[model samples]
Target: MINSIKTPNRLVNEKSPYLLQHAYNPVDWWPWCEEAFAEARQENKPIFLSIGYSTCHWCHVMGRESFEDQGVAGILNRSFVSVKVDREERPDVDAVYMAICQALTGQGGWPLTLLLDTKKRPFYAATYLPKNSRYGMTGLTELLLKVSELWKTSRNRLLESGEQIVEAMREQDRTGYVQEPEKNLLYEAFSAFAHSYDSRFGGFGEAPKFPAAHNLLFLLRYAKEENPAASEMVLHTLDGMYRGGLFDHIGGGFSRYSSDEKWLVPHFEKTLYDNALLVMAYLDAYTQTKEPLYRHIVRKTLDYASRELTAPEGGFYCGQDADSDGEEGKYYLFIRQEILDILGENRGRRFCEWFGITEQGNFEGKNILNLVENANYREINPTMEHCCEKLLCYRARRTFLHKDDKCLTSWNALMITAYVKAYLILEENQYLDTAQKAERFLEEKLSRDDKLFVRWREGVSAGYGKLEDYAFVVWAELMLYQAIFDIRYLKKAVRFADTMCDRFFDDTEGGFYLYARDDERLILRPKETYDGAMPSGNSIAAYVLGKLFKITGEEKWRERSQKQLRYLAGSSGRYPAGHGFAMQAFMDALNPSQELIALSPEQEDLRKLRKLVAAKPNLTVVVKSPENGQELAELSPYTKEYPVTAGHPQFYLCSGNSCAASVDTLQALKW
Candidate 1:
């Protein structure tokens, strides 16, 4: 019995919250490192690799059912070298193995279970399993025993399988061919999205709907450039998500996703990236339609991020757990009686009516507040706002919500971009300040010697910057440069982009690798193009490179962007909807893009031009004053040619290879 030894395992020393959660397990668990693999080799035992995040509900479930059980732990301790990984902390490891799991099982998810040989190549892979066999599913205990028996009897066969999986993965990576993206690919992607469009519920497909904000972003571009009809789908999905329980009407953010198509019941985890991307989507919607509702949602979601997920050092935290007090959604779920007791009869009844709160309840005899049934809920009222504030306060007192305080550079960069977009669109000064502050936090904490790290928690930063981190930080810096017209941000962006190319770019294959070349080498290097929940690193790299090429007119950047786009074109051709962000990048590559250089000695004129540029999705702007003209020139050498007029601002509009005549007035510059 493993539980007989009360001492903690190796995971007790790990900084990751997910690893720390398993520190007290009866089974001895090792954090992913060289020592664990060395031990596996020495002991001649197969490695049991488990990958999951802290907020994942099923990760918690499996931990409770198997890892914590003495009998199961005994079996694992005897036969295998158990290693745990927080997928968020080490996405590079997760990506390589998750691909293996999917290739082997045709599916992938959290609480990933795998049996690997001493070399770390997976021979067996599956997602969740119980302690004992039930419901036609093999249990963890039985599986572990079987694998142990196989390791002793058929060791060669197991090693051969591992070798085959690795070779096959390498072959699959090599099989990708570069194809020139055609204009028709955009239409093909649009058609795929239209096919899966959930006409009634606002998202695509069936149950468990994710707020794929990148998909909406791609559709927005399509609507603007191609068909006006595409916009309705975006609007409907945004509205549907807002009205559903997927959105936290009382507390202000969105949950991870919904369990049903109508968006009624959510999994209740509130992630920083989801909120950040959703904010961008809503802000773009507001800009497109001038819809006040979209604006409201953007503000509320940002406010929620600031209030709940933000660290005092100005970096955003990872997410909040879906479970509280060992029960899923306990902190979020509300009883009708509790609502009535908190708000009194009249106000409570009205509040309950507006939000779909009923005595019968929608989830496990508790209510998840939503406005799906109420059409007039959009009407602003002081009483409803006040009631929500009171309920928020009361909910805090009732139970505790677990917050994942680790700040990831990629997710924080995404929020920084969201805040910048909000500031530009809403003309909010605080949003700009917030964006700049968070960028400063990243530069100070998560970066070392000009190299970005993946995560920071409790004064310790770990993991070399991955493709997502570098791409997103470049994106954030570019956005900040546009927001404040600061040469420093643009210069930093250029430097980081250069470093990113040196470290992660695959010269022969054409896409960025998930992990840098200098970082730890896993079983196989992965280049992910499929956008799941968030935009893939290659997609963002393609996007920022295109923007860099346009703004700076750097031939290197243009070549890199074109190469990345061609690589993506090959992957996205078969299933374009899945590569929504890459498709958006391709759209940018195909469309007529304009870069506007606004130069003025007067600050007011430059300020007005900033707003104008923000409204035009196709336009990239760089503002220059006589004071910082030299600095601007260093970042964008072409900008040095555009002279700053003393009183009137000069605008140089460049599209394709041609430059328009300088126009002093904003109205004279044709969009």
Candidate 2:
């Protein structure tokens, strides 16, 4: 049956791991193109737009449950023009539809399903419906029948709702936007978080805890600037997660999200974004406390990335599937007897005790460790080192981990920043080298025609770079510059930033648009700024501009950054908690930041620069080429006075209005 349906899809020729994933689906699905929409109109059939990415756990679930069923596929093909969209490659379409779905259903998530009129107006929307009616939600068949009935009998009703939804989105987009001034917005966000703080468990609110690593980072920034309680909220959550089953104690990375509030039991899905963001949060936590365990998490997460997710060429994969053998959590969840079988009697008992695995079990007679429950027992008998070794050995046996081998540029950029920052703080060269290798992997596979593509699976690069790709990579470039004084990198970054300004920048509006005008058409061209689960492109654009201004001594960059703040000023108060990550970018906008330009070749300057950078709280440093190093010399000119013994190190410290004295020698570099 699947073989019959594979005949008409353009996905037959595509290389994306996600596209290939649906290649065998019995539904005659069409990839997003004018062709599918044209066919829908010609056939006078409604369109079924199924938007999802390769890594979404529920996406996989819906695919297996609905898409793979021959009977459901037949229904999908006959009743509607089924169109599949990889949200990662086409986020613009995803955003518009996701917004409409949330508007119609009052909730939205992946495996997004929308039944549209032949005219391409959404009439009905739902996410993750079962093939047959089982759960409280309606069945896919009944949904198709109902929508078809409406399309034939009450077309005006569909059109009216569609028009209303779009108009509502436009009005909201225009209103509730205001400019951020200081930590008030951030403090307000923290104040909101303070209300939701789980004093016992650490993360905000109750059950289904997402790592919200960026939120925690925002908390730390808040802690540093506005309130101690804010930072405490982050650290306590980190402690809870680390101690919880949310963290795979043996494996280095985090699962998708916890099933319950305590972070003890997870949905058992490991994702690239979760791990990447968690790595960033843990690294930041280590920066604050220098606690050995947090440092261990930093290395462990990286190690996990290196071992499972890393492509042979060096870039990381998109994510790992939560389901295997048609059973969710089967690959990750373990029975008590199996643990003893692999690890033997003595080692197994200790492992079971450490992981809190018992015969009665935590989940269906299986154990998922809410690990640090018996902290006293662990502390007195075994050191953390002993526990780590045993757990690590036990975790190594899970060989069925499903890694989504599609390398994504935006996600990789985040990883690069995390790795670069970790190496900077930890003084580990391996992490730095791995960061460089990942960057090189992106260039080799994802960049062509000076335009970066989004996904790299097999050998093909798919889609033009999204705003996230440009913004995060620009941020990563600056971080790379800070870690190693690469002049070429600065030049390259300037060129990319300039390209971004030309292609995606909104000259009329202050903020950067989500995609270039040439990008695939969607209903709306929204300029996103507030951070959600992921960082917003507009916020990141503002972030880059602020950092670039400090680096190049350009006033225009500063002006642009300020304008973005103005655009995002409204509605920021309403969802300040969700906007925590972007608030860090907002903090950059308000601060008179200095780009601590280091003047030297890449080698010696890197060594000298690390000392200048290490252990400095709240200092944002940018390394510049030795040649233009003097251009910023007016900022911190004291570096030129004292010649160093080994290799010359010149530092230029420029803030908002004035330049501090530059220092060259280690002695002169004293703060």
Candidate 3:
């Protein structure tokens, strides 16, 4: 007799670390594949789909409690075809089911569990079920049995419900088709955020606070001479987060989010997307306020990423796990004595007192090392940088944390933009060089036949590129061109933008889909416009489209961008906090970006010109050496006829079809 049982199942060959984590589960888990669906049909069983990332703590907890239990595995194997999906790897699938889960339960998160019919329509959805019922929660076993009974007794009703849910989702997505946001939309968004701003804490809302860095960026732009409150909100939030335990005082990167409203305790997971966006936010804060602290945070966060998250091959990794030694926050937390021992008694005691580290501890009798009380690092210890080196060295000797080494295209592109921003603001060539190297890695390793791929690990790349990947890559390219005056990067941005429209744009609908039409695995393609932990792909696409139109003066790009803004404008303007990224894009459309064309051969003069233009909000400045005029003219056709005014460098401020008179000196170059 042939053996029908496989202990490791099919996930053993999967590239995703989250999927591989369950490869040895007692439950026979198949990856989200056609074979899994086929097996469900063959067995006449409901499909159990679980989606999460490698770094999710609840995902680990659920795996340990239910997936590892032989009894639960037996029940699962006998009645349901269980399939696991890494949400990070297959976000298109996750988004569709997550929308259902949120609609049914009114909230959604990781370790998402759903029961689907053989046709792959979901009838039930949930997040993080415990093994045994407690705290008024339903246990996995009871839920499994209940689902099985329902499937058996009311098969037709269950199928109908699943069909209805899918159709409802499709209908909901199709309903919003508006043209252009109202004139007062941006003002309404600012007002909504102002009303919700946590004055004492610096962020918006209550416990489980996220950074919401994009919102801060939007506020920074909104804070003009008329709206000073916008800048105050941005500054307060930046100060609060940096002073909290959410930021690693020693290692110099931010955690995923704060578990508490005060930003004292964090979830402990560190993500590339968070740090990248945070760096951009901090940079914006620095530019607006000229605050040294914001600049320091940007440097520290980027340094941490370069040291810890970056691969030897030049690509940035996905994230670091929350748990170490199978315990949450073990690697991050330090005992009072441990800190004392790490540094000598005098230095350690001083460090502890300065950082609010004590024997009582803020988190489970272990210090999280925050500056909540004494927010000023320089005031507490002028030699804080030296002190951090000691703590970082000591922490390095502890139990090693798990780092998710996969280089995601969207995330890497975001990091590249962060570095470019840092360079533009701080005038740091090293930051610019780092950005260029990462971009080269993306192009050389992640691109095949001139098309970008999404995931890359250990020199291998797989998965079709998503809208985020295309949008962010275009964004990075545009920033790179602005920083280096490279025509090649500009051309590349245009090419990718064209490709993005071809692959992800919905012809009937104005917005871009998360997945391509040809991507057959997804049950329904999702068009996400809301800015979550990261900006939505559609939001970035709209923003990038606006910028492209400004740089290339393409009316078609502007038209497409306007269409997207119009489609999303009503909802975004109504809830600006929810659609911060889209609102930023809409704002850009209303005021076409200003471009400063400086024909400067001298490096010093070019730097000065860059500094002058960088002060302006939402401006795209191009600085070109006279030697590269021919190629630059070819790339940006409008710049072709305009000759260098004198042997000395000259600057022209261009807005739409008009260009101001050329100025030989930076002082005369008026905004």
Candidate 4:
């Protein structure tokens, strides 16, 4: 009987560590599958869906309290068809439930619990309920009983509510913003951030400081526009954050957020999405400024993901849990005694003092792995290349924390973009190779026809891919193409972009929907434009659509891109955060400013041509090799084609997409 039960709801372990975590759960949970829904219908019971990613602290808490509790298990097994879902794996399922939970609770978080009718329509949802009910809310047992009772007594009401929500979830607005965002709006947003900026702290808001990298990205662009200090403010905050506790000095990654505003304390969970986006931001900063510290963080963060979060199958994992053994931040937190023991009193004291690891400790008598406690690695600036190699090794010696190994396409795509960008900036060929390998793994492994699956843990693919999967993957493919000029990546991206335009793009409303038409239903399809901890799909779509137009020169793509940007432009003033998409979109909207520089076989010619362009401010230059480099060369009217007459040096100047006539020397193009 036990073997038979396991076979019906069994998850085929593929690559995710998170799904495997539930492989042995007694509740007879199945990954998102038709059989499970069939079972629910056959049993004539509501579906008990638990959605969470691996690194979620609340997810871990809820699992220990409820899933691990045999009493709770008994109740779940007897009344409902229980299912375990990693939100990262099956974002469609999570997205639907999250919408319901947020609408009902006014907020939503991990460890999402929901009751859906046999048709997979969610009638009720909540996040992280305690087992025994101590925090003013009802206990899990009581809530379960009440929901079950409601299902039994008022099935009609549940159907009505679920149907209405499903309809609402399908609706999308197709009208673009009335006009493009004016300069005043950008100025006003920057001014607001400055006024609210925390002088002592790195972030803009109070406690639970999210790394607001999106806002800072806007700030950097704004600063480059006119206000020099505006850019400085962003850099200053980033510097503080890098030095603060939010960055895991020893582990080579960042925590979810700083518990305090000053960036001295963190919530301690390292999310793959957060790290990936942060690395992108940091890499951008490093590219423009050549800041060593920013580059260090980027490398370290990438190293951490590659070492710890990567699956053997070449895909990236979701995250690492924030807590361990019921104590918050236990696996990561360190005592002063341990530090002293690890590196002796002198270096340990210095490390503690440098990273703010005092005798009293920063969090519950244990020091979070922050930079403040370390010796001033920045100021000292010894031969240590960001202290990542040694620290990551040392941190490994301790209890390796539990990792969430679910591979979400969106998150993997983001990481892919980061790796591609880092490869471009650092000229590290390995990063690019790794990026392509991971992309291949997703394409060959997780994709089913045109529809993409969100999470793959332990070799099992579960959950429907949402709009995020398309947006982020398109963005990643674009970067990958740019990193190596691959046509295949571009072609794949083009096909997916079309689907996004046809299916996910809101024709009546200018914004995009979070889920595809064929995906599961939730409270609302949720046209999310706000840039919260991460940039929203609507915003991402706008940016990606704009890029596709630039790459492919398709006017239809450009129009769609404009529509997406315009959609957000209407609210850009009120929601500056929404402008994350607008920022990248703005670049494409500009008059195509093109500059091409060609190099002869001579080194001096290359340097002179590079300096000529680099010396100019606000201009982006694209370089080409002399061998088979005619794509840009023949197109460039400014730069001479193949062999230079001088045979020593050559140069090209171009305007718009077209280049000026080729010049034999840099001096030929000079005034």
Candidate 5:
């Protein structure tokens, strides 16, 4: 008989929710640390490393199937120094091993299973092994026994293979790739996206459509440069997603991705990054087309984040799980009778018809809400909002999915950027306030020695900041400065930019490394450039440097940004869809928007100019009172002689160290 008693492992004392979830497993799991490595070395055992986050469905499945099983646990405990790592906490570790896994197997994903030597170099890698051999794949128990035999017999070959893999990755990193950051790069990206564009269903590729939001941002910028097709693709995808089941009609945010091309079904997991990136995309769409639908989407997404994913301490949580009560999408799906019970017969039937809710449900015998069938639901029922509120209230009483409440610096930065952008476009003070609160929380809780850390939870912060953390937070600070015209924020941006250079920048090579040079645990420091689910550190760093150059008028900033762009140009041109943010950064570097400074103590023109800047979409406007001219002069020396004329605010269009004559009327302002 299987043992019913729970055995607490080393993970019981760990802080990560993912690790804590595995604390009661029969397998003696160790948290990723020097102590774990030391034990592996002392015992002369191979380290079995498992990397995943708390919200991952497959991670949970693997835990239940293999980790919780007594037989599988016995094999692992006897043969390997099993270690559990939360990918979100140590993304640097994940990046290095994931690259190795991809190299070994030509693909990689979580829950990442790797067999490493005592020195932490991976010798074997795979993802999600079952308890027993099934579906023509190796089982965890069998794999463990085989690995144990190999360790006893072929240990030399295994160590040699690990050494060779590490060397090859290092050699690959040393490759000096450079290309021109020209307008043609943007054209190439647009061409690639156009070729992959799904004319019928919207979005790129086949079934399993991911919301690669940076691609939309790139296309939106591309459309302005005389590419109407790009804009059409973006708008179609946005509208398709808005009407599809991938969007929570009851809740406010998007799931991680749609499982099918039609977006009728989703993976059911909601990540803070996806929602945050979607908000930016919708805001960009609203800016371009002034579409009310885009505006509504932005509002709904932000509201969902605020209501569900936000923490009590003003920081945002990581994500929500796909499964609830051991059933996938249970909390979200509804039966036809349930809709009738909640909304009554007349309205319920109409709601059912509109959302494609039938007795024969779209997913697992229950309807997942969607507007795919009745696209004109709003026209059919004007009281749709009230009905939705009623359904939402009822649904709230159900068992909610597990949420990952760890507030990450990089993820929080992305959300904060979205909030700042929302405030800029919508002119909502609450958005601005929310953005400021998150930034303040990050600053106070996740920072030490004037540097930001990776994860914060339950008043404890650990892990040094990665390159993305510094780059994204700098982007956030710049956005905050643009919205509020706070010199302190701008100065902080410059400070973090400097710190990023010191910590992550590759002096000999051009791109930034994913981890700090001083981080000793990493076998090989990976220099990542391709934008995956989120923008890469190199991409955001180049973007940040380009904006910093424009803001500070520093030649060093321009030179560094150009160098970084040159390093990224090859990937940006060759695989445009993969490097969407990098392409956008390249475009920004090529033709940066002119900086507009509205020098006035008067509130009216400054507000008008700020709104105009928002509407214009390409200009970065800075507003300051003439009374604080000395402060502006100290912060930015170029604005020293500029003054408010005749007690009325004046607008100066400045580009590349030259400012035009001050203009009073908005019509006289030059682009």
Candidate 6:
């Protein structure tokens, strides 16, 4: 119930889509800044901090139910200094505060609500709240009044509680000791995943299943080295996800996650990171098992990204919202009569049978359009493809879906790597071209003075880069170097890695911090290791460092990667399943890995050798031609002694610190 004549708030000046959505609310919302804290201190009032992203559905619900209400706004304006933050733009702030919420409430999610003192230490934390009390939940207005009363009457106690929480967090951060991970940690991680896996449904555990693509990537690596049975779980889960509503079969991208164990109903928000990581998972599946379905899924997912999420400047956008026209899932849902009218009688009936679009729908009396009911869903035909294309076009004209158009550096880097992987595995030059274009986009727009920024939108870049930005951009460069055997990309990766180490790496401790040393200081600096929907910054840092060490034979890279692995081992040993990406990095460190250096003048020979190495997941390859040999020698000094040949490529294969003699042909190498 906003005022009839609404005055714009401080959020009107911000660029975040989430912040802009609340620009006209009756509640005076201040974007996160020093001025908000100064106002809170001057007024001697607690701060109400709300953190969420634009595409989050519950955030929208909370906005309508509480933030727009006149009564709730009055209490928030009079008694507390209200602040709004888009978590995507300020993940450093979100990470530190989210740890507090999870510690206090035993769970955490978006529309994150916290009552904090002027010092910015949180005392009270919760998720979504209604304006009026309902369903046994506390009303936002009542909660505000109670907290205001406590601030006046029991001020000292509240301050002391906040101080204690901050101290406890500091203490927890100081508890870990650096130690090399045990050799059996990989087996332990595999056992954890195996125990929780749902044999029938394919995903792990119960309802509300996220894609968790990093876990599947780890399993693929583990299946290659140790247990072959690990692959069954990966294959089953991949097929199950594609067949269910979690994947948009017609539209060609995946939703956020499945709301049920059957994977039939999804949350319906499409994100760039989820699709990027899933593409890598599917590409690896295709490489290891040679499955056509996995390759098809990869192509479809990448095509979807190219069509929808990509910006005109070549960088990928953050995500698409779940709601359309003020209703969740409205853009995706369809009734039987609408489909029949759109496709006509025979083709419509066939499409309905194949995609589970029935008279009685599976969700809210409308079809979600899944292939869970079809036995031959993987077998594609021309008729099915044409009908889906027609339906997709019709759906686009029928509803308005909101897209978050901000380009995040870390997510765009992840997508770049996905495109590179697709190019390598599928031999599509367009994929490589797309990746190179995104790299140029990030370099031109997001990078300034050799340091990356967090986001860029509408020609304005803001916020300093975090660990994920540096780490993933380095990863993208490494992938680019591997795809094309370019010296410039390798040099660029090394330069960024040096900058990353200088800015975020903890020399005294082990892992990298979420934010840089010069970034704004929060209540407590956090170093995260858990791999959730996406891999953590430390995990990717460890992984790319390990790859660089293998490629360059640099002791500094090896030492840093080992230190990070030790830190991750200490943090993740108790619950190894939660740190999938960290374990994957550790596995790379522990396994018998090969480095194949191809010395030749012919580009065709180098290409064949690159494909051979790409097929083997554990092998790292570098190309040394007469033209680039001197440059390669400067980066990888070991390549200096290897002689370049004229007609065919001479391969120098090194496995676990031992080198075999150079071979003339692929048959002679006996790989």
Give candidate 6 regions above 4 Å deviation.
1-5, 645-648
Q: For candidate 4, write residues 95-160 as lDDT tens digits.
A: 667766776678887788888888888877888889988869778888778878887898889888
Off by over 4 Å in 4: 1-16, 41-43, 164-181, 188-192, 287-289, 311-314, 369-377, 380-394, 427-430, 436-465, 484-503, 506-510, 516-527, 571-574, 587-671
- Model 3 residue 96 CA deviation in Å: 1.4
Per-residue lDDT over 603-639 for candidate 2, one digit per residue giving the tens place of the 0 to 100 score = 6556766655545433556544446555344433433
**Count of residue pairs whose backbone atoms collide, per candidate:** 0, 18, 1, 38, 0, 0
Candidate number that wins on lDDT, 4 or 5: 5
| Stretches of candidate 3 exceeding 4 Å from the true structure | 1-7, 375-380, 623-630, 644-648
Overall lDDT per candidate, in order of appearance:
0.90, 0.75, 0.85, 0.70, 0.86, 0.90
Compare candidates 5 and 6 on TM-score and give the better one: 6
Model 4 residue 412 CA deviation in Å: 2.6
Better of 1 and 2 by TM-score: 1
lDDT for predicted candidate 2 compared with the true structure = 0.75
lDDT for position 558 in model 5? 80
Off by over 4 Å in 2: 1-10, 176-180, 376-399, 595-605, 611-618, 622-652, 662-664, 667-670
Q: Model 1 compared with the native: what TM-score? A: 0.98
Worst 10 residues of 4 by lDDT: 612-621
Question: Per-prediction RMSD in angstroms?
Answer: 1.8, 3.4, 2.8, 4.8, 2.1, 1.6
| Consecutive 10-residue window with the lowest summed lDDT within model 1 | 601-610
Q: Relative to the unseen true structure, what is the C-alpha lDDT of residue 575 in candidate 2, on a scale of 0 to 100?
A: 75
Q: In lDDT terms, how accurate is model 3?
A: 0.85
Off by over 4 Å in 1: 1-6, 645-648
Expressed as tens digits, the lDDT of each residue in 1-671 for candidate 5 is 12338657888888899999999998899988899999999999999999999999899899899998889889999999999999999999989999999899998888999999988988889988888899999998888999899999999999998888889988987765788888877787788889989988899889889889988988988887648779999988887887898889887799988989988899999999999999999998999888777888898899999999888889999999999988889989999999998899999998888888999999979999998777573352447767888888998898988999999999999999999999989988999999999999988887766588999999899999999999999999999988778787888888889889888887765889898877655898878988878999999999989888777667788888888988888656667667889877877767656888777636666566667756654577766675566766765676776665547867788776577898876668877
